[model samples]
Target: MFERFNLSEETLKALRKKGYRKPTPVQEKAVPLLLEGRDLVGQAQTGTGKTAAFGLPAVELVDPSRGEVQVLVLVPTRELAIQVAKEVGELGRERGVKVLALYGGKPVAGQVELLRRLRPQVVVGTPGRIRDLLERGVLDLSKVRFFVLDEADRMLDMGFIDDIEFIHSKTPPRKQTALFSATLPEEIRPVIKRFLRPDHGEVRIEPEKPTAEKVSQTVYRVREEELFDTFLRKLEETPFRKAIVFTQTKVEADELARRLRRAGFRAEAIHGDHSQTRRERVLRDFRRGRIDLLVATDVAARGLDISGVDAVFNYKLPLDAESYVHRIGRTGRAGREGVALSFSSDREDDRLQRVRKVAGDAFRFVNLSDRPVESGGRRPSSGGRFKKTFGGRKGKGTFGRRRSFGNPSGGG
Candidate 1:
């Protein structure tokens, strides 16, 4: 399959070794342009093999003989940084191209020490850590030739535009740039406008959205102070209700999960605060049905391509209308109808109205909080005999081997 695309023989061998025969749509389109040195923006939904689309080109262009950093890749989270760096490193191993993933919450001393010796040719890191390293003179970006801002829109969504500029400032102007995003916001448009050469390419690969199909939208009204209590009572009487409660804040995620556990609901909290190892465990348990509720902030929710989410509860209002859509999308996946409930406490009436306005003609909403709560809720049925699929949630509970990336970039 790669023969038709004219990839370099060295890259072809690596792909074959990994059993990557045919390329995903994003890879097919983005690879040719990227290898040609066409600065571009790749628009594709998650899980469409996005990392490989850009990773191969980056690896091929790098010069391992000169150990100065040649490629700078920025991701939103440490997990993602590690994931990208690993993928890049794996493909570049034979060529002696080293990759390092630098992010917060991990030991900085080790990374500094590694750079002093190996001085990886490729550096993958989140915006904050990258900025920290640059400011502290630990990372050298002057010779960097390739720069990629992965999940650019998500960075904008998390308000990382300023940090991106700071990192970009450290790189030489002659560097080639590529950006990958699911959607373009006004904030991201300017990065292309200001940084990318005039005539940089754009490749949009649309992926199928099975998760959108299984979601059933609903609404509930309650008093502000009693809202959390009301959610606890609702699930008590509900059946077959394995759920993911989406909260806007990490604090709210921890607090709600704590309350749910206290109420006798088997629950766990997953968010950016948890280490990659902990997040992997949480995803495993949730998928295994050992945990009934998995409370998560938005960062915890994205990039989890698993299905069979029985319910997605918007325990609090989404910070924006689009996030609301992405939150409930976790359920109602894989062509199965799933429940999505949003709480509309009196204080959040205006926010609910905004949701309604944004959700017009999207999904029908039903009022359920008005119904009398059953004296006691029924136990939710388990997910049935575990089917061999993508395994478990990354931070929740999982079922099979979590994908492993041996390289520092974790690109694949």
Candidate 2:
């Protein structure tokens, strides 16, 4: 129970109210050390509850009466900054701890006004915005007691190392530091050494599989010209409450969303090219079910945490295995069953093989190019082979060789 962590009653009460019962692996390991004021590094995925892992400690350590920013969290994207700020705000609500989110896209003047007016105890923001604020002398980090770098690898990938370094330099060296990432590569080692204490605590939670266990993955080989038509047919044949279609480029995402809308489907596209207001509006609609299908590129969809996505479609296959896993991971969240469909062309066979190597028995390959397309295709019967493929049941052909995709009884 959270009480075992010996957190304040207010924090514990907030946790209970939020419906968080037991600590996840990351939380169980990192929470205690963070409470002890130890510098730490955690290796975990997006849905592993890492936010609460560090957030609980941050809330407990900050002094609400100080009326100054005591905790600073740096993330890779604007979406993540908002999410972290909201979560941390909730965690600190019982203690009357004020929280603020600062990021680019939104007007910086408003953020500066909030910083001076609210006197927030916790601030979450992107590296660029935080650096910008620091340069403008509006964001005060000298009083920041806790520094957190979330998704360090992604920040490095986005070439935010210099800005991260600048932000880190602004904070006091004695502050408690924590870094979290899904993977720790060599490029991040130097940053870790620079930002963290020499003897920082480390927590690594190895995932059971490269992708979510409840997600059924399938690959369909089709000719390049027929890919979109096959995708439409699949959409007609499958039933999903909500789905996200991933494209390789922002242009592709926009075009696909337009095509889907023309075909009488509720669809919207989100990418970096879109303004921040528009992106948030589209995401809001998607979450409220106003939009049933969302077309997104890899970067735009990164670090997004949306629920009830029952299906994911790869209109264009990602070049790497990691991107493929992340794309399919959009569905099958929180143990809900989901389906991931990918369209591969003849030239993309090599890319498909790489994904297969990473996904193991969880991936099923089927040839849909030979199948005749019918007008207004009917849903596959529950007991039919097509349905069986995604229902965790063994079917003829490729499905027979693999164990049930989502069935826990069928051992990996």
Relative to the true structure, how large is the alpha-carbon lDDT of every model? 0.74, 0.82
Please state every model's RMSD to the true fold in angstroms: 10.8, 9.5
lDDT tens readout by residue for model 2, 23-123: 99999999999999999999887878999999999999999999898999999888899899999999999999999999998899999999999999999
TM-score of each: 0.68, 0.69
Candidate 1 C-alpha lDDT tens digits along 1-412: 8777676677778788888889888988998888888899988766778898888888888887898999989998887888888888887776677998998887888878888888888999989888888888988999989999998877776667889998999899897899998777676788989879888999986434324345556566566777876666555544333678888777888888887777767889987666667877888887776777889887667777555676778887675665676677677655566777677665555566556556654444333344322212421122312111221112122211222213323222
Q: Pick the candidate with the highest lDDT.
A: 2
In candidate 2, the residue pairs with backbone N, CA or C atoms under 3 Å apart (3 or more residues apart, or in different chains) clash, namely none
Worst 10 residues of 1 by lDDT: 384-393
Off by over 4 Å in 1: 157-159, 211-234, 240-242, 247-300, 304-309, 315-329, 332-412
Best by TM-score: 2
Error of 1 at 350 (Å): 14
**Which whole-number lDDT from 0 to 100 does residue 244 have in model 1?**
86
